[model samples]
Target: MSSNLLEQLRKMTVVVADTGDIQAIAQFKPQDATTNPSLITAAAQMPEYQEIVDQTLLKAKSDLGAGASQEDILTRAFDRLAVAFGLKILEIIPGRVSTEVDARLSYDTEGTIKKAHELIAQYEAAGIAKERILIKIASTWEGIRAAEVLEKEGIHCNLTLLFGIHQAIACAEAGITLISPFVGRILDWYKKDTGRDSYPAAEDPGVLSVTKIYNYYKKFGYKTEVMGASFRNIGEITELAGCDLLTISPQLLTELQGSTTELPRKLDPAKATAMTIEKIAVDKASYDKMHASDRMASEKLDEGIKGFTKALETLEQLLAERLKKLEEKAAVGV
Candidate 1:
């Protein structure tokens, strides 16, 4: 294991595990954990987790009638799955676990607020405190505003899928608990756009994006933590040595733990404060106009929302089928 690298990083950043696999999380021993609808949906379908799905359906049946609306059943399934994952993750990690709001509600302020509260309620019912859970929301201006309100009520938020400085500045002004600027996705966009080798780690666009956010946040004294996410490789990960947090996948975490290389310090608040940066603000209208103008941001935000929504829908369908089969078995006295 990269004990030296780990020591070097532990002095600067908090490492977080980005996965739905509890066992893998335990192996890496990240301080925090994160998961999205897609990861939860994938985990729910695994044979090892069939019992979780069956049990969720079984309980929903007892609380809901066969004719219960799919919306209610799906909500219940999502809550159960998220809480179950959080519960398992809590057993290993010492810090919070970020559970995302329904991606479909990314732009719906009220809906996003309601879902964040609902997820926190589920965790509370499971005996997990609000401090141990972070409701992850999209980095849209509306989402950031919703999270700002939620934070006032003592619910922490993790701004996810963030790609630009505008989103970061908005989240900072909004007083979010943390911001997870996507690292690899931005890299993907640049790679696809340039059709050439990406910039070296020192100049990689994705790494630079997070660095800019980190420096801005630190310089401005924004309490919102900066957590780098969606990394494509260890080079990107190691380059972001001193981010407030880095949510890495298990494979990459394993690689980081296995390597014995020197890890450099790429971010430091004292240094960041000395750099020149412009102060910006994005209100609802400005955010909308900016999002509309940037085809990449607009298209990617839309695509990511759809992808996550579809995964949630697939999980719900599977749960409904399971519920129907169980009901039929009980009715037939089989």
Candidate 2:
């Protein structure tokens, strides 16, 4: 066993890189990688990836041909831009890459499902398989329902922005492949709500929340996997050391690589199964009722969607500016 905490932790959990930066992914070599609109937009702006951004834009404009509205080009370009990044990520990681559907479709089940198919088709067109791509949808009841339909078609999904048990249980019951409970986001809510600076890693609201969800899934023998995501610090990551997976940012991954502390398993399936925990039957009615009472989940879910939507709007505007520059250069025969 390696003494490094990152290596030690990997013995029990699948480590995933959670950024859109290709250099970081190449450096850390995580098993899987995940990207959202915000990360993609940020990475697309980086000078190193300008070629990727330009190619996606050029292709989108060309495919639409003459008289295509700028809106149509922008929409198609965003979709292709996301997949272009996914393809680059997939080339580096042996596992899967999650490409999210538009956040605006978070509550639209039919639209989410349709978008997932479109993303998957783009990946397949590049000779990648559905198994190597995970469609990331928000954990709304509608999103979970959309995932249920995709899973049956052999397209796996990752239910993201999940904060409460209601959403987690609903995703599991829907037979979703994976659920990424936002550990740090949950903690952020509690700290702001309680007016505290910090909580001990053990008592952190996010850690406790994911621990509860992890055990519940294990105890019930649910096949759905729990991947702890959006961590704020090393404590939260180390606290959930034995989780099925942890999607971490590059900074934290570097810290773990530098630390030699021995990591211990905090979540065990056998222990969970032996504990006496009551089973709660979750459906739309119960999920709605429970979610309504869970302030952190509701608030965070709403805020998270709005945040991603704003990022996407920023990206569209940035792309428009970039497209104009490219067109001007081409017209000048430079």
Candidate 3:
């Protein structure tokens, strides 16, 4: 059999599975895995994960007491479910697992920090160390600040929903452990706004955005890792062959594993340093201005947050229905 693109990509970059499905993680055997509300919700519907959902619901009912409100039970259940999935993922991958905070808390720095601590606490309670987990937060200004605080406390963070250089720079400056600069979402915005059918990987705006962020990070000697995320195609993945990491979906992973095409290294720190790009600093005003000026970045950031929020709400609704059923079953027995 010929060599696969995924095996080739692994030679230079860390491959992270971007699904909450444990079976897919096992199939791909990625170095690390990341889970969000959407993924977790989707996986929860599968029969294989229902036991986890049921157990989490039972525990929430017991811990929250009979008088606890439905919202209280659901909030605790979701936390437990997220960590439960992370724990299962940890058993499969030797590397870290990223568990996200609620998207609704993206703009609240203190809320985000509190939630991060809560997640870490849950993982710790389950015998997982802080080093084995990455608290995924949205890359809003507040989220970056929350990550800064979390980093100081020895909690590593993966900043997501990043679309602009301002967000990347702020995240790097905050000493975040990693930043997931979305590639496909950027391309989606550009294609919609410009009415273009498609662009080659080299000129793809999403690819360019990630390459720029990767170069900037390397040029400045920042230790923050740039993880290219939200890939729409194998071309985008191959174009970013030498990124610090790439969190790819299972579908794309399958496509890559089947392809025998040569994957060349497209990003190098040495080459980036030799380039004539000027260094720019971003403060609050400049950060806001730069983010505001980029219509794609601003619109997509908001849209991404809202999309995740909707998925989270759906997950909550599912849990509420399950919890209601469990309560009813118990009542019948009583």
* lDDT of every predicted structure (CA atoms): 0.85, 0.95, 0.94
- TM-score per prediction, in order, is 0.94, 0.99, 0.98
Evaluated with lDDT, which candidate comes out highest? Answer: 2
Off by over 4 Å in 2: none
Q: Ranking by TM-score, best first?
A: 2, 3, 1
lDDT per residue, candidate 1, 162-236, as tens digits?
Answer: 888778888888889999988888888888888967678878888998998899888888988999999888899
Candidate 1 collision pairs: none
For every candidate, C-alpha RMSD to the true structure in Å: 1.8, 0.9, 1.1
Cα lDDT tens digits for candidate 2, 207-236:
999999999999999999999999999999
TM-score for predicted model 2 compared with the true structure: 0.99
**Compared with the true structure, what per-residue lDDT tens digits does model 3 show for residues 61-128?**
79989799889888899989999999999999999999999999999999999999999999999899
CA displacement after TM-score superposition, residue 90 of candidate 3 (Å): 0.1
Count of clashing residue pairs in every prediction = 0, 0, 0
